[model samples]
Target: MSFLDGKSLEPRDEAYRTHEITKKGLPLSAIWKGDANSISQLTVFRHFDSASVSEGFIGEGPNTVWVIDYPTLERIYYDLVVNFDVFGSVSHQILTRMYMDYLRMESEALFLSFLPVADREPILKHWYRGALAQAKVFYGHSHLLIDTPAAIHYGGKDPKNELIRMIGTRSMRSTHSARPTTNYVPSDLKVLDNLSAKKSLWLRYLPELSYVVVHDDHGEITNVISMVVNRAHANVSFIFGEEDRRIPEEDTLMLVNGLLGSYPNFIFWIDQSEIGKFADAAKQVSDTKSMDQWVARYGVRRTDPRIWSVLDRLHYYKQHYYKQKDGESEGLLDVSRYENL
Candidate 1:
């Protein structure tokens, strides 16, 4: 049977909304409009003993639906990727390729169906023409499409402009006209130093990534990291420096204040320095339950067990990862040592 078959996929029909409570005391029925719960129901179909749930609010006021599933949401995601061509836009195709590099049969099969026809055309041509640069451009385009946020989400935040600056140097090597071709000056060292404020578009979105680089004793950036809190919107905390293994107090204060002041959404990067500080501050709030306080501090949207598990995993990496001799040996960094930690 189809995934939605057993539980009729029809919209829940009830004026006051019929209620069926899960063991946890949460409602299992749909209420009001746009409830993602009604849209996607969770079910187990295999030997995999674990799964996660997801839910989203559609209309206004006190009604909503609960959507549940595995953490990866693999089934639904595969459907979306296979169906959406826009995912492989010239801007992000390259990044998408790299993101999928590690996937095996099931994952690769899902991604192969996502590339646009036009995107397919160039690669096909390159196969015949044997032009290596053309192939690189195809990959580059995919990279930008997946790595960068959409234009509508910009809200004058200049996502493209910032990327043009941050990656302009390396981008220059792709092709004369590959990226940052026109009026896009590479962001200089000075720009990187004073990036305290970030622009967010509307209340719904924030930057998906905020990157910082800390240089080593040799004056080379030895540490580079991205702070991400939102996927659809892009609110990121980016800082770079070598001497201190701590996010600057000003940056921390700024981020907290910005989150508390802005819309309900708050996003931040949780790197070693920040995680270390978090552990320290978490100690101060020890009187309170650690797990509960940790969730509150991170402002995680879901309290679901699987999501909590991922958060716990993050905590595990934070605490135990450093003790190890090589962070890279643990399925971590493969890029520059700056990115290794």
Candidate 2:
């Protein structure tokens, strides 16, 4: 606490200020008001349709759940943000990053502590593919971790995946005391979950971010999902020449419910039945010409007449349904940054 006593954050808006409670920022409002003692007291619920998601979301499972326990949280704030200088020298930046790395390693180790001890090393190995052997030792054995055995009974040979399924099962709650925080994915959209790395080789060609819409028999938008392509790396040990570490074969596709990004590389629309056929068509592409044809069939190209209409429909869905499903509405997606053929 003494370390952060001199530091203070400048308030740019009414959201972070001690103001009258509004419809937005209900979670932070609870803490500012007398309703909640801490942020932990406020219920936070999230739904992830895919295991392959952001490191912040999945860490390396369906989601990353780190046990910060107040002290670590305070340290993370002071060490990562308050202490980091944007206008400082290169050495200052590198030092801050090194401190953050050590913190991340410890936090990740803490997350792994929640899983069965036998499963810990293997998951650690997968998460840190090309790290030096000594770094692995510190992350695994040397770190101060939660020593108690995991309370949950894990199933299957793959406990990491099984844990994700368990969390998903628990979140299918019909009722919760706290207000729901985000878009409730349509149960029918579960079809996309079946597409895996083993079967869906076409996933390699997909862009980093994609907005996909599936239509019903009447040509009405039945479901909206985001396909996030996660590229695997050999290591996080360098800030320079990072591209050399790319291992495309190890990449994974994440099917996220609703619109996930502001600027999607492309938007693909297809009927429910055509999804399999679409995958097959994409999988057969041997060159750019074939790839272009596949895009012509399934994608809403920038030059297409239907592009604006598709964007409008997506925006409409976000406001009409998501505003209530989640506590807040996101800003409009700007098409100027979107990729085209």
Candidate 3:
């Protein structure tokens, strides 16, 4: 007889013998109730711990009256207990974006990459799925939540400011919206020599991106853009490398100065501690604009109404090292701390 067919037989009947509940000499009445007939025919197995129970089949409880197949139930239960956060995050991304679009509002986009060792492949894949889910959420809201692989025009058509083509993927070819505009090689002589005259080194290995993202690793990605930027020899370089990579603080000053002419109206964010260095660099480049004056006229500080109407609202403020007021000493705060005007 089929096991399920046998299950239909009455548990109290002679054909289906019931096992007595016992613990030493005591009856398991608390769980089974006082009447012997009330005891369930289903075996009462004890799990070693919550983990074992958690790994059990998914779907509604025994009494809920549902019909989920075994394989599906098992998959659901395993995901619920072992990777709940990832599943929930992905679901939330989709649902929340839908809600935002229903309200006809744009949602802010965020991109995140998770890095984990090789041994934790399952967990890492879940993170990648979670990121895709987040992207979908933003897309649902009628907002574009694009991944880094997205290619489009970042600069105008003017030859002086056209989009730089990092010499890597032709993926942008598929994305007709952002065609190859400019070579955009950096002006710095040193970076050019280092990169072997490659104007667009970032495109060299699009295949690697697939695996990196699939594996949910970001170490390679973190360096790609910076590597591309360095090749162009731009005055202001955003270099990335292994953890031991040195950020060239001194040369950064030169690049910031060069940006003054190229991107004068642009606002920026830097660590509060680094603000002084950037300011000093600006001074060395041009004495006409002091930090306070620049903050008052062109920076985000200007638009702030609480303290001094010092900053604009477009650029979001973030934390940085800082000096304390009242001769307190050096510390850190967001630009808002100074702008709370």
- Highest TM-score model number: 2
In terms of TM-score, which candidate is stronger, 1 or 2? 2
TM-scores of the candidates are 0.20, 0.66, 0.19
Q: Point to the candidate with the largest lDDT.
A: 2
lDDT against the true structure, each candidate: 0.27, 0.57, 0.23
13: Cα error in model 3, Å: 63
Per-residue alpha-carbon lDDT of model 1 for 17-88, expressed as tens digits?
233332212121211122211322121111111221212211111111112223224544554486346746
lDDT of 3 by residue, 68-152 (tens): 2233245445444543555466656454334333222111111111111221233223323324454344334321122112222
> Model 3 TM-score?
0.19
Clashes of each: 32, 0, 29
lDDT of 3: 0.23
Q: Per-residue error at 215 for model 2, in Å?
A: 5.4
True-structure RMSD, every candidate: 22.6, 10.0, 26.5
Cα shift from native, residue 312, model 2 (Å) = 3.4
